[model samples]
Target: MAGLAALGAFAQAAPMVTSLGPVRAAVFPRLTGLGRPGHVALTFDDGPDPASTPRFLDALDEAGVRATFFLLGRMVQRAPALARRISDAGHEVALHGWGHRAHIALTPAQTLRDLRQGRDEVASATGRAPYWYRPPYGVATAATFSACRKLGLRPVLWSAWGRDWTATATPESVFHTVARDLRGGGTILLHDSDCTSKPESWRSTLGALPLLLEHCAEQGWKAGPLREHGIADADAEIGS
Candidate 1:
């Protein structure tokens, strides 16, 4: 059944443990970035890349849509103006770690340092502090949770993703891949940069944007940034 399949897909998407998928879906639904009914959160990661991010900005602007951009600290440093431009365009800017490495591979101290540096860079660049954090590769560890707590950040992961980082991805594929698991109140993950992906894969993501927006329109569900998605920190007592 369609409902059963969506449940299955959600379980696969929000794994608490890298090896255990269902537990997180069952236990931490809020952390999975499921927001208020009739709304879908649009989010992009690994960017502020000058090459492709601008294209996404242009597309989003033309569509009259806004999104959350989870920016890497190192990338922001390379293009602080572009990073600020994202915020200036009314997009929600969030942290995606200082580097592209997974938290599970780093020591506790390293993880904490990475988050602090990233949070600082994003705040400095955007002139607003980020309240949300999404670990690189969506992999979270004890240290990651600890760091988030210290930083006063709420950790969020996607309920659906485009898997558009592959070299072979096309616009239609990206749109459908996300559409498969997507529903109202779901957060959709995409990448605006190929800095950590197969080169130029972001072109596919850019092209997929209109289809996704139109699909949400047809479904009568509003699509916008996480801030507008109405995901409250009180939804769950994170790091408790």
Candidate 2:
């Protein structure tokens, strides 16, 4: 009976993972990280890498921009000081779980445990509790939402992605990929680390940063971290 109940819960959540495309974005804007008009949210995932993250940080600093970095706990543990540097440099630090595993692959108990452990690890390294969560591969389950509620974390996914994880991705390709779907009030996803991607893929992402910011500036849009993207009010209304 206990096994059956867990299976039922998993069954109910499995479809959401596969169905979170344009329709889901249109129906659940807040969950897709949509926010205020004339503003764009900048975010990265699977990072705090010692070699590459610093370069991304330097690029953002030079551009006078900040972004939210969704960090993996194992990565944070390996580079705690770099994690501290991320917060100290004024970017937002958010949880990306203990490992880069999809919630759909974990049972409800496993999902909660991963989130809690990652949240604590991030808080310990950054000295600030993370307010947002982005699951690996942008896949969320019913367990993901429930665990976020229990841990006081809000789930957010990107509206536009650079597809910068590929070996074939170039700076121009990254920019154009994001530009194809990016609009004001959209969230842009890129990677600052290549831990889960092709080696040195972050270089393409780093190169595309200037182009993305320049494009946003040309459109009279303010691009910054999620905190400044105005998600709180939208989330409040949607979650209610």
Candidate 3:
């Protein structure tokens, strides 16, 4: 069954290793300059929806690509089967809070509760806790980072974003944003589920995926998990 496969993959991914240590530093991907061979990480947020998630998965399958998904805990509870599909397909699943609330507005205790609930729901659905946490709308506070460290999740923010959460954003616009902003070691943010809108804002994302993947191939850019690059070390801060 799909659930068994997901469990097997989770074991292979070794989520327990991620939980073993406290995070010292969080490093996002460094941007690469033009004409240089680079790497990009593709990430999605706010989903596992029935309508849009399947389409996104089909596109990723067609492209032979993988991505990280920061899934909302409440949504996972609503669509546990779809969450299993995401895990079974070999994508990284991370936390995106319980209801997509802004972290800056919540007390540290409240933030911890939301993160704990989100991680628990995701792990329950997929059989492994996530190692990354992306705050809703890229809004983070000192409290958010503290909570992340306490929960054994690293705070992951994108180096570039497609702003695909907008209902009016066209596929072409999404493509342009990604292609124009891409750099080596950059994290590109896209959405597979849009809980913020009435019908959800994933149509543009679905339409933009193939073009983005093709462009990455043309540019010789590789894509992988966010943690694969490792956290930014003390040296990077000194150099920067």
Candidate 4:
């Protein structure tokens, strides 16, 4: 029965992971932002690594940019100080999950528990309850939405990602990948931690940061954290 229930849960979640539309709308509250022209938002995931996170922070500080960080609960527990630093540095700290498991892999109860636990862990570290949540791998289901509403958090997804977790990714490739899809009011995804990602995957993202920012500058786009995106909960939703 347990296995059957898991399979049934996966069935409901599968559609949302691959395609956006009715399933996307039916499952979660709307995702706002990612529209307009020249107002790109930069977001990072799976982070707060002591070694890499601070480096990213330094880079963002030097660049005069602020970003949103979707942090894993376990990682936050492992590096609370680093998590605090992220919030202290004026970045948004959102919930990723307690573990890096995809929503489909968890039962509805488990998913909610993971979201709450992750939210609590981050809040403990940051002294602020996060108002945003992004599921692991950007996969969501009816349960994810339920959890979001119950926890009083909003859901967000990206419009473009660098694919920087691939071992062969380079700065040029990362920059080009994101640049091609980047538009006005786009949400750009990148990683700051190698914890759940491919080892050393953070390097390419780090290397591409300045270049990506430069491209945004040339295009006259302003990049900042998601809090400034000015999106409503009635907007379109994104799939994994």
Candidate 5:
């Protein structure tokens, strides 16, 4: 019976992982980046892997673009230099939590502690406090917002994702998935590391990025990190 209940809960929460629109509206609509026009924020999560991160960084450098990287604390502990390399490149370093576990699995207290630890790890590695966070799997439970509020982190959900966290994803499919819903002033989600997601998924994302940037260039769109997406410096204030 407990197993059945757990299954039911998961069944209910599964949809929010793919589409956070309705859930975000009730929790915090403004942070969702919906209906905003003219700039797109590129955000990468679950990374700092030596094998893959430098590839994406080189691609971004070649394209002359900077993105937001939501780093996992545990991974940073494993690869601090790679994390610093990300920050050193002028990309935004934000938190994706200490462990890349779903919010539904954590109590409010545990979530707060996770947020604090993740924030500290990034700051210690990058010498700057991360003011933004995107929860694992993009699902936010009741505890998430409270933890973010207390932690001084702003909760952000992507408006477009490449659906690249699968073994089958190709660069073409990833590009189309994001291009279908992408617009100016929206946040685009991709993975630079597969640390907490499907293995080798970062390859598809890396392959798709240049095409996406070129698409933006042709559209006269400005593509960059969150700071350029209009979340004010004041809104990005570091918290305790």
Candidate 6:
């Protein structure tokens, strides 16, 4: 019975994984509208900080684009106002764990506890439970998926990452990595907060924002939240 249930769930979720290959999967609600042939979604994690988040929001405002923000529960508790600001600015706020810890290393119960607390904290600040949950560092396991299922959240991953967690990564490098790897249904990972030891990681992404937006525009692509797209099996006949 357990195996059958698992198979059913997998079938349901499998369609959410885009065939574009290895790009991160974004759970619904945090996801924006579906992109055309070459469109992509931009997502930022570990945010709601006073230092970098405001500037990031400012840049998004200037570019006239809305992106997904996977926020840490602890950060939301510390900066509820900033969390509110993100929502008010029309960006989707999703969960990125309670403390931004690794899920793969945690027991299933521990993972569930963290996810529950994280969802509650984010909902308290933003007035809605985030529909998406991104594991810190893209770490996932069976326990992680189970916890997500229990909480009614979906797992999202990225197709292209800027490696902005590193201090040595230049803004140009960030741009190059994203622009070169972008494809339809791709989710790009970045960070709004500098939790890393290096301040350059945050600065590099902030610096690259305008250029990245311009590149998207030049490619005739627009940026938005991840929830706008729906997942359905292309091979499954509707009336069959």
Candidate of highest lDDT: 2
RMSD of each: 5.5, 4.1, 11.1, 5.2, 5.8, 5.8
Residue range 84-155, candidate 3, lDDT tens digits:
899899988888988887765677899899999999999999997998788786665556656766788866
Model 1 weakest 10-residue run by lDDT: 1-10
Worst 10 residues of 5 by lDDT: 231-240
Candidate 5 wrongly placed segments (more than 4 Å): 1-17, 20-29, 34-36, 232-240
Instruction: Supply candidate 6's per-residue lDDT for 169.
Output: 81
Tens digits of lDDT, candidate 6, 1-240: 343243234434553333333332332212222345455778899988888899999999988889889999999999999999999899999999898666646778998999999999999999978987777766655666678777888766667678777857888988887777776656778899987436647899998888888887887766677665332321121111
How does each model score on lDDT? 0.85, 0.86, 0.71, 0.80, 0.79, 0.73
Question: What is candidate 5's lDDT per residue for 1-240, written digit by digit as tens?
Answer: 332233234425673644745454333334565433677889898888897999999999998999999999998999999999999999999999999877777778998899999999999999989988888887666567668877788777787889898878999999999998787777888999887667888889998999999888888788988877875432332211
The sequence of per-residue lDDT tens digits that candidate 1 reaches over residues 1-240 is 332234334434553342342355455667778888899999999999999999999999999999999999999999999999999999999999999887757888999999999999999998989988998877876677778878988788888888899978999999999998888898999999999999989989999999999999999889999999987663243543
lDDT, candidate 3, at 129: 94
How well does model 2 score by local distance difference test?
Answer: 0.86
Candidate 4: residue 112 Cα off by (Å)? 0.5
Give the backbone clash total of model 4. 3
**Per-residue lDDT of model 4, residues 200-229, tens digit only:** 989999999999999989889889888887
TM-score of each: 0.90, 0.91, 0.80, 0.87, 0.87, 0.82
TM-score, ranked from best to worst: 2, 1, 4, 5, 6, 3
Screening candidate 5 with a backbone cut-off below 3 angstroms (N, C-alpha, C), the clashing residue pairs are 38-184, 39-185
Each candidate structure's count of clashing pairs: 0, 0, 2, 3, 2, 15
Error of 1 at 86 (Å): 0.4
Q: What is the lDDT, from 0 to 100, of the residue 122 in candidate 5?
A: 90
The worst-scoring run of ten residues by lDDT in candidate 2 lies at 1-10
> Which residue ranges in model 6 land beyond 4 Å of their true spot?
1-38, 229-240
